[model samples]
Target: MMLAGYLVAVLAGLFAVVAIYAMLSSLPNAPDYFSVVGVSPIAALLVPPLGMFIYFLTIVLTGMQTLVFALIAEFFSLRNALLHMMFGAIAAVAGFALIWPGASENPERWADMGIIGTAGVVAGLVYWLIAGRDAGFRRPLFERA
Candidate 1:
């Protein structure tokens, strides 16, 4: 169930980003959802689900980063949101860099950064909704206070 929820959230985020990108670019508004589903298996054969895994890991790590900042840096929730946004932007750029190296010089790269960052923000919001607005880290491996 947890995995299913995460998958759905990630896919939804991806589709939302694609849609927004299309709209902003004044390109065709049609989103080929079937293409994504159809290509997953072939793409996985090349990188073994690397894209999906990276997105999931990025979301989880961003949440952990947010928690760390909130706890150690005494950051407010707003600051936490900013931190997550920054992380998302960096992650998206870095992911693109790893995949396409010098493609950063392209104008479209900036647009992609915007889309991916927005997706990250959306994912974070969804996660917070599911996990709770005031959720905090807990340590089951350690003795109770």
Candidate 2:
């Protein structure tokens, strides 16, 4: 059950990242694929055929950070909402760093990073709600066995 919960938490965070990325990227001046050329933003989200690639790619990229944070949280038995949020933000920033090397050095890239970080924050909150509340609960016996 713990493993299942952890998986769910990670999945929730990844989805949150994809969602925020889609929403923010749909704004004016974003990439052509994200922009609503002949369709409404709502419609674009509803029919995210192109965005599917981005969604999967983000999950693959950010999954590592999420797993790392999960290990730390589990090891420390952390359940604080703020800490989880921070973890989320940090994971998102790490993913952004990987995707856009040197983008952080530029002022314009800061905005995009900010968006990713924001997504991570929300994802963290979601994770806390799901599994952080009972982090490492009653698991010592399993280790012994």
Candidate 3:
């Protein structure tokens, strides 16, 4: 269970990294900041091979996060966090590929991306919901699940 938790955090972190990198790469000027009904500071680090590092880190961090949650959910009884993380990551990666930025303008692509995104979110939520409660995290779903 301890190992599983570590894996989940690592994987979740990795996912964040990739998502951030993709988002940043798609934008211009390494954007100092951006907003979506609210303001957020943009990352400006200049890590070489930033894309590749992000990709790897995302895989690791997200895995760790997922594992940690899954283990907690199973009362430190389950030992399959790696499997859960792998499958969930697969779903997310597929969503990312299908709903890439270019698809924003293409109706078909946009629709596909939406579907994929929804799938990824649902899968992730399911894992987290179960894990959180099992682990006694007891926090309300931040975004209504």
C-alpha RMSD for every candidate: 8.0, 5.9, 13.8
Clash number by candidate, in order: 0, 0, 29
- Across 16-46, the per-residue lDDT of candidate 1 in tens digits comes to 5656654554545524543454345456458
Candidates arranged by lDDT, highest first: 2, 1, 3
Residue-wise lDDT of candidate 2 within 64-86, one digit each (tens)?
Answer: 88888888888888879899889
Per-residue lDDT tens digits of candidate 3, residues 1-145?
3344343543453444345544644566643332220111123235446645644554443454444445554554433534444545555545355436566666655434543344345455445444432343343467473
Per-candidate TM equals 0.46, 0.68, 0.28
Candidate 1 — which pairs collide? none
Q: Candidate 1: where are CA atoms >4 Å away?
A: 1-8, 27-86, 132-134, 138-145
Task: State model 1's lDDT.
Answer: 0.50
Best-fitting candidate, scored by lDDT: 2
Residue 125 lDDT in candidate 2: 78
- The Cα local distance difference test for each model comes to 0.50, 0.72, 0.45
